[model samples]
Target chain A: MPWRRPRKKVERPIEVTRSIEESLEDAAAGEEEEDSVDLAGLDDATVVEAATGEPEPERGASDLALKLRETLAREPAPARARPRATTYPESGVDLAVDAARGLRLRNPVLTASGTFGQGIEYAELIDVARLGAIVNKGTTPNMRPGNPQYRIAETPSGILNSIGLENPGAVEVARRYGVQWAALGVPVIVNVAGYSVEDYVYVVSEMAGTPGVVAYELNVSCPNVKDGMIFGSDPSLAAELTRAVKAETDLPVIVKLTPNAPDVVAVARACEEAGADGVTAINTVLGMRIDTRRRRPILGTGSGGLSGPAIRPIAVHITYQVAQAVGIPIMGAGGVTSAEDALEFLMAGASAVQVGTATFADPLVPLKVIEGLAAYVREHGLRSIREIVGTALPRMVE
Target chain B: MIIQQGAVTASARIGDLGTVLGVSAPGIAAQARAGQFVHVRPGTSFEPLLRRPYSFNRIRRQEGEIELIVRPLGPGGEWIASRRPGDLLDLLGPLGTAFVIHRSARNLLLVAGGTGIAPMRVLAEQEASRRNVTLLMGGRSVAYLWPSDRLPPSVEYVTTTEDGSFGIGGRVTEALPELLRWADQLCACGPWPMLAAIGRMREEAERAPAAPGRAALLEAQIAVEQHMGCAMGVCRACVVVTSQGNARVCREGPVFPLGDVAFAEGEPATVGLVS
Candidate 1:
């Protein structure tokens, strides 16, 4: 007889088809009287994340995320998040004393002139309704294509872009974005650039009474080809341009300063003195990248502005200095990718923050930063964020 | 077109299909067109941060599988070639301007170089028996040439190889002058040099107006390629110079009338068209 193998039993992987509430019922069925031994050493935070399906809590987050979170938190997001327990007293977060002209933005996270093109591109990514206001791309009197290839360059931490104010011009932008801006449920700020004083007047005047336009950001930092006056580099010229813009349009005027300026504080002071509503700091720092293969300048213009993470330290420094010199609100921008980055600016004395290249990398950066700040605020037992403003400034040694 | 494929759709290879697009999608048989292309995303899940574009070589409608003929130039193309059939691709479209048919013209000529043959095949198939068509195909060698079986049986096929490994030892345009005299309209899509040659020849022929009714040369259109970023007209990265300044290759055209374009050299093939 042939050697016969015993009948084999096939085992299949068990399929767990737990019903909606069956798992709970099973747990209830196993109710025990004796206390269970704690063999698995898990932390409380881990338990909370597992139960809630949330990421594990992070420790030692930079105050930057908190600042961005504070401003983003002010946005009346329908779903309220329970405040976390890590927030501190106003180290740099502030929600009080903010206005962009007549527009009552809770805080000043105004998009920089060229950075925010239109509301539609970032509609899903940003809480457009919650932003203090959305700034339009730098526009001109005539529809211009702006700059050539490589207008925007990616730096280590940010991006350097010389879009040369490429835009649909004031007429087209106003017509296209006017109604959409209003629907954004936020203030619509248009960043206007001009080769001449009339160009500024004409573009602003065209939008003077438009319902959606909450204010005008005078892109005075632009290289003026007409009068050979660099509006941002020269304080007097910046002041003059600001006053001229103020006289021409009823819209609140914001003067954006160039980081390329020798003294950023004086320029901020000048814009504030010129009756401008507020100021935006540090357009991309002029820089260039070399194409190793071609052995020539990578940018067609030979130079471009650098942005991203590399510039945040500089932006915070500038904001801190400018806030000290000017009473007007300071909208700080640079390499802000997280709430922690945004907090640094606030501590430096900026009331609001603008996110630039980070949006390109992660559209959710702003929202995450906002959520992070709220968690921080609540964790620290602070009722409001104003307690943190200017907390990092060095006290006089006298 | 809605293509439901398991995963091979995202595996796109990169061949110099004449133009450059920054962000492209739909790699394998993703619903595409003859002259159309899908934007290839450079990385897995938005990491590389930019999308590349590729031409749709052929479409397998029954299987909802499309083919892309590519030569990998970057990690992205290598990435597409490595994917297995079951991989799901986040593909976009059969986008950009397609070849336009002139019902009036009875004869057609299709000139292709390298992978440019992909889109032209679609037009060739549509016009196969209905009209007279002559396909002038050129490549590096006979083996490197497109499979002749893919062409319509009605088309008179001709091939040229640079190394004399195929039918003729010269460029495709070597046979064009004689053909141009006979073919009513020339719709050539390929390298700028070849199209520019056609442009020059068309210009020379037009200067004389080809003795009255001898089948006037229909306006020639070439499907130029570029580094297109946003398939929509937003980014302005895919702009080619036109007689009317810059025009978007992705939005306004991937195909243009040969006469209207101003070709730029060096970085990549640059096309200028009359917008």
Candidate 2:
């Protein structure tokens, strides 16, 4: 007789169907357990079972199949449940923060001074009411025509601007944008830039009763104009200017610090001592770009203030240092493009953040940052975003 | 003005002139007028940040397509120019003010220089069928000249090259006086020097006695270019001194009446008095 294999035993279709049903039931039960039960307490085999949703081995199964099933069942569940730990909160996390002592806002994101022109310009493109507040273009006691041609130039990841604080006089700005600002439903932080303490007082006095004016952002560091940075760079001048403005208006006074200052922290401290409610750490760093082809500087002024991601690290360091040194709130500015960047400032002790040149790249950046912060808050299961503020600071030994 | 992602359908180098890109942006094309421009994002990242503003080189509303003439100069411009078909572009437009064409005017003169031909080309095509339109374009040389075939057949095209390699030998100013007399209205877009030349001519006409087309020169509208930021009115980076005050190029203009723009030494006049 020819060599013949032993007669193979074939299982009935009904039997096969029953086995499959048993296997599926086991898998379903494993998946249910994985969904409802905490996997952290489970053993390695149970975790593998939960992960793979594989059924237990059947009787008469091949050795190979048994071994594979055993290996899968023994494998540990993936390190963590998932990257996102918690669902978005029903009420959502609060993004509100204070720009100054009494200048509380619904969000921590505000438009930087000068970058946002009186809230009316960007109001057409975005919902202005969503912003923490808007710091209007630098306004003076008198109308300014601003810098010459080529007032702006693009640097690596930032913008260099020498706009020379161009604005209609305080009267005109108040007259032109008062109703518009009120209508926009966004608080206005008047950016006051002046040649002297008297000029600052004049501007504050001019804007005293303007509707929607919530506070004042003293732009003492406008590097584009002559003598504009004097008050910002000198502690005494800054203190005097802050005191004069404080005397003029009951509005919260925020001194915008200039990085070009020989000692920025001293100026901040002086302003705070002079009754400033808050300080915006670090204005644009002075920078220059030359057009090799033209054989000359690109800006009308040889130097312009650089603002963007290029200055973000420097801004954060300053905010961190100032936050430790000052008692008043710190409004962090300079290259705050995302919620993470804002969070960096917040954790470093900033009470709020201002978005500047990044707005040039994307008008919706501030809004996006707000959304991102909310997402972060929910994911980390933080009760409130403010809980993260100053978390990165060194603790006191006392 | 809306921001939309437009897809490039075609891109090609137009000799030594610039790269021409056709983007399918229905919203921008539908609302676009002659002098309005689109701020195009260079890349997905913010490395070479800041959108590049380009006046629409060609707009086809029915087809929902817009064209841009991009000179690959900076990294941003190079990135925009190198875009191929199917690439997406972020566009914010049709922004800024548009060139205003008076309906009653029978004769319309459009002047352009170098890349400024973008808006002028649009004016030529749009006004060709409605009025007696003449487009006077000047470039540094033959390399910078806009292709004649791209213009509408109805438009009367005149060109000047500084090198005498094309049309009239010299600047558009050389060919402008005779045409200014023939035209009832004038619109121009060009470099600061070229626009300043026209502004000087307008000033001269205003000082002298009334003559044919003198009024047109006085009322001429020109689209200007500057080192722009935000393209939105917010940045205040593109302000040029105007008769009224400092006017934002992105809002008050890219288009302004020639008489309103202030020029000093062939550039936008600087505001000398800060106070």
Candidate 3:
């Protein structure tokens, strides 16, 4: 008698088929699961993929009997019933927060300037409408060619960059992105960077009525260009620039502070006194990495701005100090990669958190943060995320 | 620009040149074109942070597989090169512009240096069936040259090693003149110095009344490399100066026309106001 091998288990296939039938029944019964599975509407390739482990190509291996035998031998579980998680907006949690004096956002997570481009670059990979808002690349009065080659270098737990505010100028940006911004569903925050108060005023006046632009975040903290740090480093200049921009546009003006400043809290206080709606706690720290073999700096510009997890603590500290010094809301930035990190800023007295360098590592981080914040609200039995703001601040009056 | 999770199906060590990994990514493979690259996450976490970009060495649409030549340069590259069969890779790609071969061209020349052979090899395989193809490559030594047996048999392979351990003694440029004479079009991908050398040739050709391969040199296209961040157009890193002003290597390029690119002393010219 010929030796015969035992038939492979068909348990997974049966489970997949059973799951499909269960989903169909649930849909027919008008169950509340919004993402119901409808096999009938699926394409033939998808149906084949559901039955088989992989999609069958149109050519080569199209023999019917071979496909059936292969499908049977493979453990196909394409239709497994996964635990359904509620979407962020419908999670019955209040995540609304005032990012600026007049900028009311549905959530407290925003994309940082210089990292999110014009918000259109990532629209293909993610749903931009889910974010609280998006801050576009820092725009200048005139088009900048940007820095030289080797604009980026990897540090220990961060990255150093010297991209010198490369943009198509303020007028061009507003003209090119105005219509798309209106359709993106997410509010737009224009990041204004310039060499003088006149430049800032020029950019603001040009972008005054652009669609979807809810506010202006003054980028006074760029570390890669000559005189870029002038306004951010000097409290008087920052306040002056803030007042000038607020005069030009009716939109809320939020000043972005730099960690390189001698007194970051003083800058925040000055901006607040100058009628600014809010302030971003911190921008990238100035840092450098030298190439041993080349005997020179790694970046095209010797000293570049450092960002990522390495600067998170510094940002939180600045946020805490600035919150105490000023009455306006603080938009914390620098190296916020996860929900826990965002919560750190929130508890430290920041009204909203900006996901920056981390977006380069993972594009879905902002969405994850929104979901995680909602989960936190549900877990803590809190009515709104705002209830936790400044919870970690010292209760004792100085 | 879809982020697809690819499974490793095959891995081979190509002498001392590099390690080649065959990945099954149907979505990326189907839409991939010559000169396009995939940004691969080094690991599941963000330790290495930014993703490493790798050009496709082979795109087999029928098999739903793409091949990459990964040379372990640092921790991130080592992690990617160490992946074995069944290992999953998160790839964001088929990104950037591709080399466009004019329909009139019957003779095509592809020049490569170092690991730049990734895209050059792709062009050879893609154009070999319909046209006469020649691949000219150079490396420091014989160990760095791609194995001719692995390439399409119809592709004419010529190489040079600095130490004279391979076919030709000097650099790829030493053999480029002969190939340029017989070619109607030229495409190169390599380090800054090699590309800058080609840029000089293009300048000379355009200046002279009638130089050999003048039209081809003027129309040559080259893919460049730079220290990149976000591979997406967001970060503004990896920018090179061009006749059209600043262009992002991740968005506008990784591929550019020979005459359009600006070079300064064997490197991409610095943009913005120099200190």
lDDT of 3 by residue, B63-179 (tens): 999999999889889999999999999898878778888889999999999889999999999999989999999999999999999889999999999999989999988998878
**Reference-based lDDT, residue A240, model 3:** 86
After superposition on all C-alphas, the RMSD of every candidate to the true structure, in Å, is 14.7, 18.5, 14.4
Chain A vs. true chain A, TM-score per model, equals 0.73, 0.76, 0.77
DockQ, all candidates in order: 0.06, 0.25, 0.25
Query: Per-residue lDDT for A162-270 in model 1, tens only?
Result: 5556567778887887766654545677778888777888898888666456678777667677768678988888888889899987666878788888887888888
| Docking quality band of candidate 2, CAPRI definitions | acceptable
Q: What are the lDDT scores of the predictions, listed in order? A: 0.61, 0.80, 0.82
Q: Tell me each candidate's TM-score.
A: 0.68, 0.84, 0.85
Q: What DockQ would candidate 3 receive versus the native complex?
A: 0.25
Most accurate candidate by DockQ: 2
Two-way DockQ contest, 1 vs 2, winner:
2
Model 2 TM-score, all chains together: 0.84
Q: Kindly list the interface RMSD, in angstroms, of each predicted candidate in the order they appear.
A: 18.2, 24.4, 13.8
Sorted by TM-score (best first), the order is 3, 2, 1
Q: What clash pairs does model 3 have? A: none
